[model samples]
Structure formats: structure tokens, C-alpha cells
Target: MPAQQKKIIFCIAGVLSFACALGTAAAIGTQLWVKGTILCKTGALLVNATGQELEKFIGKIQYGLLYGERVRQCGLGGRPFQFSFFPDLLKIIPASIHVSVILFCTVLIIFALVGAGFFMFNAFGSPYETLHGPVGLYLWNFIACSCGCLIMILFSSEVKIHHLSEKIANFKEGSFIFKTHSEQFANSFWIILVCSLVQFLNTLLIRFAGFEFPFSKSKDSGTVTGAADLMY
Candidate 1:
């Protein structure tokens, strides 16, 4: 690629990295990770509710990493309640797994910002060919992508294997028991998936700018050294 074309590619990658950072930050703050409905098992069983009547015993629940809002339906009416994960939910949910997901999110954001800065540096400023150049770009993007994948995996396990939503619904409720009727990952969760893909796409863009994928050069060099040895 021409120097001017490389510069354009670098600039585009930088912009993408920055956008991923902003999107991740926004996702962490918003209460839109999981969306589901909780069935009031106690109430439904008591009333022996069937079909259409069961709707009265079902409530809606949604949450993010930090805090969330849920509408409790126990056959009487929907009762709105707000909650936080810091201290309130520590006793109920899988605190370790939840905390791990959050830690990875933080890691993803930090790496994304660093990657953006480095991309800009490589584009405009003269950088060291080893650390601050192509190698650095590959390293940052790979780490960010890994972090994003870990975040999603950990969170999914916490929700599915540990029964996160049902536990949250049952917390502090002695008389009424709740069960997760239906659940789906919401917009915020999908955003992280998209951000991870963007990081991957940046790697291809780097290749489009004429940079080799990291480590391939070393293997190629070794092959040439073995060929020379055979001749001797």
C-alpha cells in the first residue's frame, strides 16, 4: 500500500477503536444487559392459575452489571423495585463470576483506548518499528478482543448455569418464590459482541494496509534458515 493509503487505514482503525471504547463504557452504565420475565411460583400455585390467569403471576425483570429494575407480579399487581449489585445483591448472586465479568469489561475498555492512541501514533507520529508499530497494534487489538469474549462467556455462565435471574428474583422473598419464565440477552450484551468483532476487523484492516499478521514473519524466517542448512 502507498504511504498515504496506510495513513488512511490507520486513521480508520483508530476511529473504530475509539468507538468501541465509548460503546463499552456506555454499555456498562446502562441497565440493558438481560431482559426476562419472572413467574411467581408461590402465587401461581396458590391460586392454581391456568393459561391466561398465569399472566397475573408473571413479572418482568431486567438488569445490568451495576444496578437494575424489576416489576414484581404476585397475582395482586405489579410491584416495581430497584436494586444494586454492589452490596445488595452480593449475598444472592454469584459475586465472584459477576465481579469477573465486570473486571473484563474494564480491561476491554482500557485496551481499546490504548489501541486507539497507538493507532493514531503509528499513523501520524514516527514510532519504534518493534513496540510502537505493527506489533503493538496487533497486541492491543488481540487483548481487547480476548477481554470482550471473556466478559460475555463469564456473564452467560453466571446467568445460565448459576441461575442469576431467578436468584435475584428470590432474594429477600420468603413468602413468595420466583422462577425465570423467559430470558434473553439485551442490547448492551450484543454491543460487546459487536465491539469484539470490530477489533477483529481492525486486524484485517491492518493487513489491508500491508502489515503481516504477528508471528508469521518468524515462521517464514525459520523456514528459510532450514532451507539454507540443507544446502550446506
Candidate 2:
């Protein structure tokens, strides 16, 4: 490819990487990761409650890694509550897994930013005989892609296999009881997946920008002259 076209491709990849990084960061901090309705099982099973009373035992909940909002309808209208996942609720929850998810998210964000910077640098600046060259593009993008994949895998495992939603719903305080009805990974979770895909595409773009695959070499096209050439 010509230098001008290569520059355009690199610029496109850089912009894409930067957008993915920003999106992943925003999803990490926002409260739209998981959205669901939780049913107050205790309230529903109350001796005084009838079939028509079940509506009062349902609540809506939405949360992300950092914080969440809940509105309970446990027979006394709707009571709203907000929570943080840090020191306050970490004590009550499975700390290790949740902490790991947060850590992976942070890693993904950092690597993504680094990859985007490399892409932009390679696009606009003269990068030669340095890590910021073609090899660096591959390295940083691969790292960012790995980080993004890990974040999604760990979080999905936490939510699905480990029953994170159930754990959160079952939190208790004195006479208050919480229960889960339904839950699903929301937009923010899917956004991380998109970020991962975009990073992978960026790697493909880098490859298409005239960089040879690492460790690959062209086969010798000339016939071997053997010892005759040495004698000459």
C-alpha cells in the first residue's frame, strides 16, 4: 500500500481504539451493567398476603460495578435504596471475585489507552527502529484485546456461574429481606464485548497497514549454487 493510504488506515484504527477505550471506561463506571426485577420472596409468602398482593412483593434493581439503585415494593409502596460496591457492601459480598472483576476492568482501560496512543503515534509521528513502530502496534493491541476479553469472562462468570445476582438479592438487615426475581446483563456489559471486538479489528487493521506477520519470512526464490558459488 502507498504511504498515504497507510496513514489513513492507521488514523482510522487510532480513532476506533480511542473510542473503544472511552466506551469501556464509561461502562465500568456507569450503573447500567445489569438490570432486573427482584421479588421480595418473604413478602410474597407472608401469611396475610393474598394472590392479589403479589404485586407489592416485586422490586426493580439495576447496578454496575461501582454502584446500584433499587426500589422495593414489599407491601409498603416503593422504597428506594442506593448502594456502593466498595467498603460498605464488600464486607457482605463475595469480595475476592468482585475485586478481581474490578481489577480486570482497570487493566483493560489502561491497556486500551496505551494501545490507542500507540496507534495515534504511529499514524501521525515518525516511528522507526523503536517499540512505537509496527511491532509496538501489535504488542499493545494484543494486550488490550486480552484485557478486554478477561474482563468480560470474569464478570460473566461472576454473574452467571457464581450467582452474583442472587447473592446481592439475598442481602439482609434486621427485619428486611431481599430476593431476586429476574436479572440479565445489560447494555454496559455488551459494550465491553464490543470494545473487545473493536480492538481485535484494530489488530486486523494494523496487519492490513503493510506490517508483516511476526516471525514470517519469504522463501528464497533463487536456486542454490552450492560450493560452486563459494569457489567463484
**Best by lDDT, which number?**
1
What is candidate 2's lDDT per residue for 68-119, written digit by digit as tens? 8888778889888888888667866668878887887788788778887877
lDDT of all predictions: 0.92, 0.79
Highest TM-score against the true fold, candidate: 1
Cα shift from native, residue 121, model 1 (Å): 0.6
Model 1: per-residue Cα lDDT over 15-52, one tens digit each: 99999999999999998999999999999999899999
CA RMSD, predictions in order = 4.5, 5.8
Clash count, candidate 2:
0
What candidate 2 gets wrong by more than 4 Å, as runs, is 47-52, 218-232
TM-score of each: 0.94, 0.86
